[model samples]
Target: MSESIEMTAKAPVRSAPAPRRTTPAPRRRSTRRGPLHPATWAPTTVLVLILGLIWSAIAAEHPYILPELSEVGLALVDRPEVFLTNAWTTLSIALAGVACGAGTAFVLALVMSEVPVVRRALMPLAVVLNVTPVVALAPGLVLAFGFGMTPKVVVTAIITFFPVLINVTTGLRAVPPSVLHVFETLHASRTEVLWRARILYGLPYTFAALRVVMPLSIVGAVVAEFVAAGSTGGLGTMIRNAASTARLESVYAAIACLAAMGVLMLALVTAVERRVLFWHESQRRAST
Candidate 1:
């Protein structure tokens, strides 16, 4: 018994088997799609269908009211130079007017945001301008600035000014009270507060206003072209001349060009807004 006990004590202890670690099964990736998935192409598909319908109507009815798409296409293709030159002219006027108007409105908005007195004083005049007919003002502008590009640009600027002023002012004042308090605690100067906080916060609003005013600038330019004496070139001028001559194809062609320009301008503003406001919630949602 003593020998057996000694052997048992000398024997090495065997350990229980270790547990095998089982990793969780890999989770399946979601098959869901974002907002910009292939389904978003529905609008473009609809547009194509509408064009097809129009083509069919032209083929069946032979309508004098609507020129054949091919004829309009040929009008554009044949005199590309004429259309290109006018398009450039109108585009330049719109660009210049937008720059001038938006800049001026931004400055005024800054002032109005800082001073209640200035805002109260200017608000009435702005309302007056907004209410006044742009067509009525065109002749006076022509009389004052002459029939050069100046009048057209001024008209566009006038058209774009109020929208920017309103939007930017609202945006500047839209900053949260907590943010302003934080700035105050930092002993930030007015200029610093404006540059650092207000301007940055106002960007989205400014772009929203821009999206509106950009297309509006085109209309303003065209209206000026229609009425301003001695107006020689632009899509508006082409349209007027073509219409007077009963050149239905040319008229439609110019109209198409104007439509294209408006779309391009809107797209441009949207693209810029996306780039600048990439961190904004709207852009975040769009990306996802």
Candidate 2:
């Protein structure tokens, strides 16, 4: 019995059966394409194809009504200086208007977001202004501000204002209840909550509005240029003068420039949004 006990004691003790190593269920790889992925360019490729088809159709069927794409391109090549100068004029007006409108809207949105009563009082007035036909107001604005860039900038600002206001206000209030509770629990001040939480959350919405307003601002500037009696330069003026003279190629060239401008602005805003919101789920998924 002593020998048996000694033998048993001599036998090496086993560790509690080694815990099974869990290979974490292999994380599922996302099938979604990143921005640079070829698949993400497919829509743009399709759009180019569609545009090519339309160009072909227009060239074949309505040769007189609309000049060939080549003619439009030639117009641009022929008078690059003219187009560039007018484009600069229009762009300046748009930039000024966007700055004014977006700045004012941001300040107002901050106030309205913080004070519900202000939002309630100002929202209807904003809606009325939005609904009032901007085209009708163009002449009056020109008359008031004169035939200079002031009227055009004002028109652009008015057009760009409401979208930013509405979007920013919505974004400011979109904080998750639980997240807000945590902020409150931490005794964060109003400014701290706004800057750290609300502003960050609202960035996506603000960018979305910017994408829209940037293009819309150009349209507003063009509209103002149309009505401003003494307006001397701009794509709108170019288009009007060209159309009056049946210069379809020039008209289309100006239009193409406008389209390019809008696309460029949208691309800029998108790039900024991606950079700013890299941490956002939407952008993260897009990156994936």
Candidate 3:
């Protein structure tokens, strides 16, 4: 009887760790995918391959004008500190100028958008500035702002502002009339319309402008530095110094650093766009 009771006690407990219920881990979005996903690394690989071939061709055909890729690589590897410091300086000028310029453009866009007459009045001024050759104006800017960071910053800003202004103005006007009408029916204020509808509508266009303007600002600052050449401590200065003594390797290295800086900024902008515009159709499509 005791043995029978023991067997009954040991038999079939109802609980068995509740079948180990677990939520599956969420999958990560991998930037690096297999060749099956050609969109991942195919273009980048192709670009690098093409660049390598062109570089080889240049090295073989015109050795004096363009140093071998290996030489540029050696120079870059040897002078890490110089490249880093100069790259930082150039990047700073680009960032500061773009931020300020984009802000000014947004304000001007708002003003022009709300008041149609301001477009006629303000556009001529923008056109004049846009048409003025920045290289020709660099010396004057240096004279006015002194041979320092101010001139470079101003030059960068001037180069970036107009394109941004045009983009923002277009974006603000691109809001659907139906959406505006809905807000109107609800008796929304001008500020509400401006912020909720127009600004949101303009974000993609503004980002597109940003992608172009940021690189142009970098170019602008570099050119300004060239015109105001000295110990300014930027990629432009490095280029000027290298070119003076015909150190083609160093010139190529500095140029490569400049390219890297532009690429980094562009990547950052793209990342921000992905985060901010995740709900947009483009982002949705890209993610899938």
In order, the Cα lDDT scores of the candidates are: 0.90, 0.92, 0.88
Q: Best by TM-score, which number?
A: 2
Question: Judged by lDDT relative to the true structure, which candidate is superior, 2 or 3?
Answer: 2
lDDT of 3 by residue, 110-203 (tens): 9999999998899999989999988888888878888779888888888999999999999999999999999999999999999999999999
Give the number of colliding residue pairs in candidate 2: 0
TM-score of each: 0.86, 0.88, 0.84
lDDT, residue 164, candidate 3? 96
Best by lDDT: 2
Error of 3 at 49 (Å): 2.3
lDDT (Cα, tens digit) per residue for candidate 2, span 1-288 = 999999999999988987889887888888887679888898999999899789878877987687888889999999999999999999999999999998899999999999999999999999999999888988888778887889889989999999999999999999999989999999999999999889888998999999999999899889888887899999999999999999999999999999999999999999999898888999887766
**lDDT, residue 20, model 1:** 100
- Candidate 2's error at 268, in angstroms? 0.9
Task: Write the candidate numbers in order of decreasing lDDT.
Answer: 2, 1, 3
Report the error of model 2 at residue 177, Å.
2.0
**RMSDs, each prediction?**
5.3, 3.3, 10.4
Instruction: Evaluate residue 212 in candidate 1 and report its C-alpha lDDT on the 0 to 100 scale.
Output: 97
What's the TM for model 3? 0.84
